[model samples]
Target chain A: MKAFPAIAIASGKGGTGKTTVAIHLAALLAAQGRAVQYLDCDVEEPNGHLFLKPKMERSESVGIPVPVVDAAQCTSCGKCAEVCEFNAIAMLKKPLVFPELCHGCGACALVCPVGAIRETSRAIGVVETGRTGTIGFAQGRLNVGEPMAPPLIRAVKARRNPDAIALFDSPPGTSCPVVATVRDADLVVLVTEPTPFGLHDLALAVDTFRPMGKPMGVVVNRADDDRRVQDYCQAENLPVLAELPDDRRVAETYARGELVFDRLPEWRDRFDALWSRIEECL
Target chain B: MKVVITSSNKTLADPIDMHFGRAKFFILADTETGKAVVHDNAQNLHAAQGAGIQSAETVAKLGAEVVITGSVGPKAYKALQAAGIKIALLEAVCPGTEALRRFKDKELPVLDKPNSEGHWV
Candidate 1:
């Protein structure tokens, strides 16, 4: 299968317009007759479909290994406690495990000389697939109380179509979840606003993604706050792909769960140019 | 006859039982001999979502006679008790290690009420 050119739209801040840019890019690519697979890797709070309104299709559960104790074949040696790095096991007076902190490493089962520990599968999230206008979409939703989101994000990416251009709507942050989503991307578009908070987080995002050595650019959303965004980009030699004006129409369209590119039409043209620039960079 | 510690340092294995799991590290030590073995559940590599279940099995697998740790939650504490794995919540890590040393010296602290929420992070 031909590998899809994966692009991840990420931001350090939560509301820096990553999703908005991702939605528009998907729409623009689809309009250009490109088969685009839009993936929402923000398992914690997926709002991409709100703008695209894709039809629902299949949903599948994503799970990871959890330990199961076997009392009958147990020696109570407590070797499993020594190997675990997270301190998830309480073994002094009585043996117990806290499920929330487990990382599913399987070392406990391996270290258990008595074979009292075994791994069991537990569901942690769900992935939903469907269509959002011309784009095929997939989103991972972490099960309530699940601390990790990377595994689910990986599951969503694993389902991507190789022939399609996979545009990832990544979670907000340079944390573990964000790294997991964009680690394999060919290019990363960092979407940010022209505000103090936006710049601060963008700086962090820059640090996180810079180490990957992948080609990256910035898209300033609602750039009416100040010229600092452009200034910083200029000083840092980061290309400013597009500057979305602070327009009321875009805000209204966002509130109504619609993509501005579809209604404004002009934004689509801008995205086309941005895509071309990305291709040139790659 | 046995006590547990989460430390993997064999040099300090006296009075400590080293056990590893997917979630956390623990130690089980003997008060009389000061012989300790480290136990780590953090090694289990299971998702953090099922830490409780993974921790329980880790203790059972190690065959730990007594377990000691910085803290523990209610669900795991209860399950450990039901499994006949004795638990001790030392308010301080030093005290837990000291208690293990004392246990090696034939002195042991009586197990007290397990903290419901766990050790303060």
Candidate 2:
């Protein structure tokens, strides 16, 4: 059996249509009788399932512990605060923790000489698995006001099937979330608009991916039937795999939570070509 | 008088770290009056796997007298103090860059004591 190809769709900035492209790509692959696993790693604001609408089959919670100091064991020595790297512990006279700043590494307990710190799990998000026809879907839903997302993203990726084409829908920005989603990708397809802001963020995304040593290509979402995006791609040596012009049909289809490939048969050919290029590179 | 933040490699600017190690980076800023340098190493270097002990040593080598950063788990803190590196625990900020910049500007509110947790969110 051939190895399943894993492709991640990411954008440096939000609102550039990463999920929109991911949905169509999954549909395109499933149309070709290939089993695909669609993972929504944007735990902060997962929206891929909004379009795919897979049926939930399994769900699990992802949690990280926020250490609680046993004041009885605490000698007011300020040792816990002394060893913490995140500044989560505040030990001027009494040691306290700021939950939002905690990464739950449990280093404080290990470092504490008195062993005053004990860990309790804090629920950060939920990973849900569902199925839509032949496509398997998974998504991480982050709790409101949680600062961390990478841990939950990694949790979703860990559940990915080795034999299914993993189509990852990454969160926006070139920060930790995007890095978590794209780090192990076989190929990264950056979907961006044709404006200055789009190009600016696209450059940042390219820089983020450059370190991973992965093959990347750009898919111009709403190419505007213009040359601005094309010129930038040409100058940057980035291959423009597909030009999705600004079309009301695509927009209308997307707004109704419908897959673009289902509405437009011709676009499936373009998606297939992009997939083939990525496969060849791998 | 140079400020050096050393990760395992020289790539601290990436913002998104893959290492999740005990050390993220050791930020070393030169002191004008004192002969010592100021620095802080990331708490759990392996969790983020970002920076390591080498980064802290680099900061110490730069002659930093004081170091301002988030947490420094006990083992690393002892080593830094043994090297005569004064430690200051910085107030946690969501964007670590802003917290680091405040330290450079001498505007960061720092705690004279160490923190009680491992991860810096």
Candidate 3:
């Protein structure tokens, strides 16, 4: 099999089975005696751990630099506020910083004339690593109320093992976080259902990834339920890698936080064949 | 003294906007001269976040002595208070000029604390 350094499984709409496809593919590859590492880049609401069941070995805090003010050395010139593109800082009588709004781009600190502005780290999320059997796993969990997720997603992706076949489970939607996860992947597998909403968002996801000049394939989940996704993929000249039929057993196993392969071992051969189809695309 | 009123349009006859930060325009009315000018608030209207704080900064920069609006968020209220700008809360939706008239008549109550939570904008 050809080596795919990183494969990002993304969907424009949520609950289209991004995690399910990602975990099953990784588990199948690991079962084939191939080294596989799964990185769940859905920092806002990562759930791959539920199925992979990795025993978390260690976790670390992720932070972004926010501006800090030195009133003693300060002149309230309002330069920091003027430089802030996010309106995270205000200088009414004194410099006031809204850390939540800050993107931590360090524009304020860079523009501060009197050296009154300094950067301080504020934790936005956490990254955890562990293993599920032979498969390596890592996931990012964004802190509640945190507006940004791209930074933490980047942190999670940075932990990817180059030697292993890294599979990234991306966040839904064609947003910044999704772009951050899929940007560096060798191949992008777009997952979608057979409904109008699915096709609409899948088109959006294609528009987003098409500009990046990366090879992409489509995986229609609940394959027999809807024909629109298949029609759309055929019209777009995108390969339909594998079509897993709508199965009650798959859904039930997923609800119980169990891998489909664990309950129906026969599905392992299907996932393995799915990898073969993905390899044919490359 | 200069007073700022959140408005849905440039004219004083327009209804006072319910949201302070996302208001379409801010009417800077001079109580002494009975004259008013409109400041466009398009930037903050579509701001991803911190719209309230940005609007408050605009009010402070305009050197307004008071702000008359339907509702003010906690962040904007605090910023306005720090700038020594009094907040006058409107009990009902009405024209910008009528809100100003209510303020002048002392019929509108002063906001001692924020009446709305942050991100209400």
Candidate 4:
């Protein structure tokens, strides 16, 4: 299947400014009269909405199918418990179902002899959709203490506006949730800093996405006197799309939940150039 | 009354497995009949998640009225409580016979809540 035209703004480490780049790009594109949708796939702790501040027009709970055993029809066959790979099901004097441990694979239901096991939707998280202005917006919010995030991330993607360009603000790290968000992206803008930790984690992020065969570019956030990040990008043959110099005003503006382009007109040009470079790379 | 003690080995002389969910063996001791059987817990020992909950069920299925372990997580504590099995805390790595003696003597501290957080972060 042909994947959607989406750009995932990802960082290997947290607070390296993946959402910083994502919201700016969305704002820049929307102001330019380009149809754009800001989809925050960082369900664990989505911050794009803090800046976009979308007026929520719709919100819905996302759920996964969990097995609900019917004891009356069960013949103590233990098929449900035996077929469960996660040990979510246990047959004692009676069958015990652990919904939290269940991955909702429905293997037990498939193996049930008298169809005693039925699947039921158990809410895990929520996906909200709305718009701030010309920019359509969506973000996934995983329930507190929920072990999984991919399902909520997928829920946000499924809520993407098909008519607009998708800018996915992904969660940090190259884990399952990150992979789920960026796997189908047409282009990925990897944001990073210039510190040793940033450089090392950037390489880890690059290694992670390189195998997926998706084209990627680097955007150095809080760029400073350190040249390691630039040198690493050059050596890896990856394009440095844009670099935002370290500025105290940028951090202050971010802390106040305001967009950099709005509060600081001087920074608008930087994001403008970033959008152009991203378009060429895409 | 039957009590399940987490064991690293089948014999009573072996050290108790500190980890409850992933314990190598569950020593199910019947205080009334003076009989105890060691059940293999390799399945829950290597479970992807919720090993504690599954282990609680394992002991409950073995007709245990009490689960004696080193420490218990929230899920396992709840599961054991729901099954009408009282959870008692004893320091892990001691001899299973020692735990059995404590269980029989009613000298172990009963867990009011989970001793540790879940394995998942």
My TM-score estimates for the predictions, one after another, are 0.74, 0.68, 0.93, 0.90
Tens-place lDDT per residue, model 3, B46-82, is: 9877899889899889889998988888788777777
| Model 3: per-residue Cα lDDT at residue B114 | 84
Chain A vs native chain A, TM-score per candidate: 0.94, 0.93, 0.96, 0.97
Best by DockQ: 3
Considering only chain B, report the TM-score of model 4: 0.93
A best-first ranking of the candidates according to their TM-score comes to 3, 4, 1, 2
Task: Estimate, for each residue in A197-263, the C-alpha lDDT of model 2 and write its tens digit.
Answer: 9988999999999888878898888878567878888998888877777888988988898887777
The lDDT values for all models are: 0.75, 0.71, 0.89, 0.88
Task: Write one digit per residue (lDDT tens) for candidate 1, span B1-121.
Answer: 5655554343343333222233345555556676656664544445433354456556755676666654555555565666677765444444345656555554545455555553322
Candidate 4 per-residue lDDT, tens place, A135-219, comes to 9999999999888788889899998877889999999999999999998899989999999999999999999999999899999
Name the weakest run of 10 consecutive residues (lDDT summed) in model 4 chain B. Answer: B112-121
Q: How far is candidate 3 from the true structure (C-alpha RMSD, Å)?
A: 2.1
TM-score (C-alpha) between model 2 and the true structure: 0.68
Give the Å shift of residue A193 in candidate 1: 0.8
State, as a TM-score between 0 and 1, how close model 4 is to the true structure: 0.90
* Candidate 1 lDDT by residue in tens digits, A1-282: 134689999998998788888988888888878899999999999988888888989999888787887768867677776677766565644445655566788888888887788887778999999997678999999987677688899999998988799999999999999999999999889999999999999989999999988678999988885999889889888998888888889888988888787689887777788787777666
Stretches of model 3 off by over 4 angstroms after superposition: A1-4, B11-14, B33-35, B119-121
Once superposed on the true structure, which residue ranges of model 4 sit more than 4 Å away at CA? A1-4, B1-3, B29-43, B60-66, B78-94, B105-117
**Which scores greater on DockQ, model 2 or model 4?**
4
